[model samples]
Target: MSGPTRRPTLRDVAGRAGVSTSTASLVFSGKGPVAPATADRVRAAAAELGFSGPDPLATSLRQGRVGTVAVVVEAPLREAFRDPFALAVLDGLADELEAADRTMLLVAQPADDPVRAVAQLSSQAVDAGVFPLCGIRDNPVVEHLAGRGVPLVGSGSPDGPGMAHVRTDEEAAIGLTTQHVLGLGHTRVAHVSMNLGLRSPTRAARPDDLEAALYLDAAGRLRGFRALAGDAAPVAVAADLTVGSGEEAGRLLLDVPADRRPTAVVCQSDLLAAGVVRAAWALGLRVPQDVSVTGFDGVDLPWLDATLTTVLQPGVEKGRALGRLVRRALEGEPVADVGFPVSLRVGTTTAPPPA
Candidate 1:
């Protein structure tokens, strides 16, 4: 049997193409200037010799930059992406990163132990880091990455010095729905909050829970609702940001005696509000007639029959804002915290309370 043939190299391709190895490299990297015919010849030779391209490791070593950005999310990939708002933010972030010729290295940080993310990311090489969603107010990953001089960007959590943020006024944003319900003459209002910590159960929110909350977004929104609705207003916390959790939270607030049940239910997310609607229906309660429902993060819900009164958060735009902040930081520009605004969208789900 004949000896195995040697794998083709850049030198072999260049020789076959009648060009210098440097010229072959230029064609492959799309750098410097090369005639069209020369480039074509190099590609043909590469094809025949089965030479794909130069080594990525070599290229990165020479460039002094790894073109990957670390995108940190505080949940498992499937769980996080299940929320439409999360998907929108990710899509927008991916778009801008693609435009800048960078790739994303997704890092899912466990909520129970955020420090675990630090270990996972320690071995990875990334040009910058992003906390793309609302996570714990403080994170060990922030400190580790900051010590390494990684450019960091975030939205409303993992707050610390030197990190640029696309800040959302969580309190004012949730107030959009709270004020709307108040305007609709609903005095008996209930709030559904996203989980304030890892493995939190769906149950009534207590004053102590708000005081010790780890998730700032949820805490801020709860404060906003309390600010308008009063501190004694009933509030339920979801186990997670899921429809199922929302349904559970809804039952806690809605499955009560008619007189005690809140006339209007305001949720921190559309998914939770939809769940409340389902729970209300299950209990033979007609929406807007028995209970008015409102939500935050105006995500599209095709399965629900009624349009939701919600806070128009524009997740994609908020994501792009985060991306821009990351880009600016990477470019050595002085990036200040950017404020993202939210608006109230009136819909069929909210109406004047039943007489």
Candidate 2:
């Protein structure tokens, strides 16, 4: 048999088209000026020889870019998708990447073994990485990727060399809602916080937990609530970012003697606030009538009967902000932290505490 069939290369196409391989490459890559007729001839030749474009790996090797970004979320994809805010952030990031002819590879960091993510990504080539959801304060994957010189962007956390962020004032953001309820004459107040630090359990927040927490956003919001609510304010921790955890937290705080119960509960997230609402209803309490509740991150919760009084942090815009930072880094532009501002929305969920 004649040797095994040879795959057609750009050289073969160029030979048939009566053009140089360089000219044929230009036609394929659209990286240089080429006469229309000549470009047509190269395509014809490529078609005749069944030659596809250049090998993507070889092209990336020559171009020094893989056109892939690692999107690291602290939770599993299933859990992340359940949160509307996470979905919007991801949607915005995807929009920016698609416009730039790039792709996103989502990586979920295991709460118990975060280093596992580093090992999984060590062999893959990426132009950059993003932590759209603020991650652990010290992340191994960030260290591994940064060591490899991949540009990094984030909403917050794992911040250092080779990483830029679309910064948010978590402390100030949470304070808006806390201050809102406090302004309404609710003295007996409680705070519901997301888990602080990696692999934290759902329970009452202790002073030590806030001090040693690795998750910066959660810790920051908790501190902000305590700052305005005072040292003796009751605080409960959610197991995760889900509504179920929020409800559990709500039950912990709301299932109490009426005289001792808080008049308002300030939550760290909208999902958590919804849970608190359900818990209140289950206990025969009317929101705003019996208690005023407020949440951070004004995500849409159509399922809930009442609109949440929340801090309006648009998730999609934040994602786009993260994308913009990533794009700048990819272009060799000097990437710097950009501020992301949030405002407060007063909805039906808050009012002067019950008479």
Cα deviation of 79, candidate 2, in Å: 1.2
Estimate the TM-score for candidate 1: 0.93
Instruction: Quote each prediction's TM-score.
Output: 0.93, 0.96
Candidate 2 has its poorest 10 consecutive residues by lDDT at: 197-206
lDDT of 2 by residue, 24-108 (tens): 9999999999999999999999999999899899888999998899999877789899999999999999989888889999998
User: Which parts of model 2 have CA positions greater than 4 angstroms off?
Assistant: 1-4, 31-36
Backbone clash tally for model 1?
0
lDDT of 1 by residue, 1-355 (tens): 9999887889999999999999999998897899999999999999999999887877888886789999999888898879999999998898888877889999998888788889999999888999989799889999999999899999988877789888889999998899999998999999999998868679888769877898999999999999999999999999988989989988999899989999999999999999999999998999988899998889999999999999999989888888888888888899888899889999999889999
Clashes of each: 0, 0
* Candidate 2, residue 222: how far the Cα is off, in Å: 0.5
Which regions of candidate 1 are displaced past 4 Å? Answer: 1-22, 44-50
Q: Tell me the lDDT of model 1 at 46.
A: 98
Residue pairs of candidate 2 with colliding backbone atoms: none
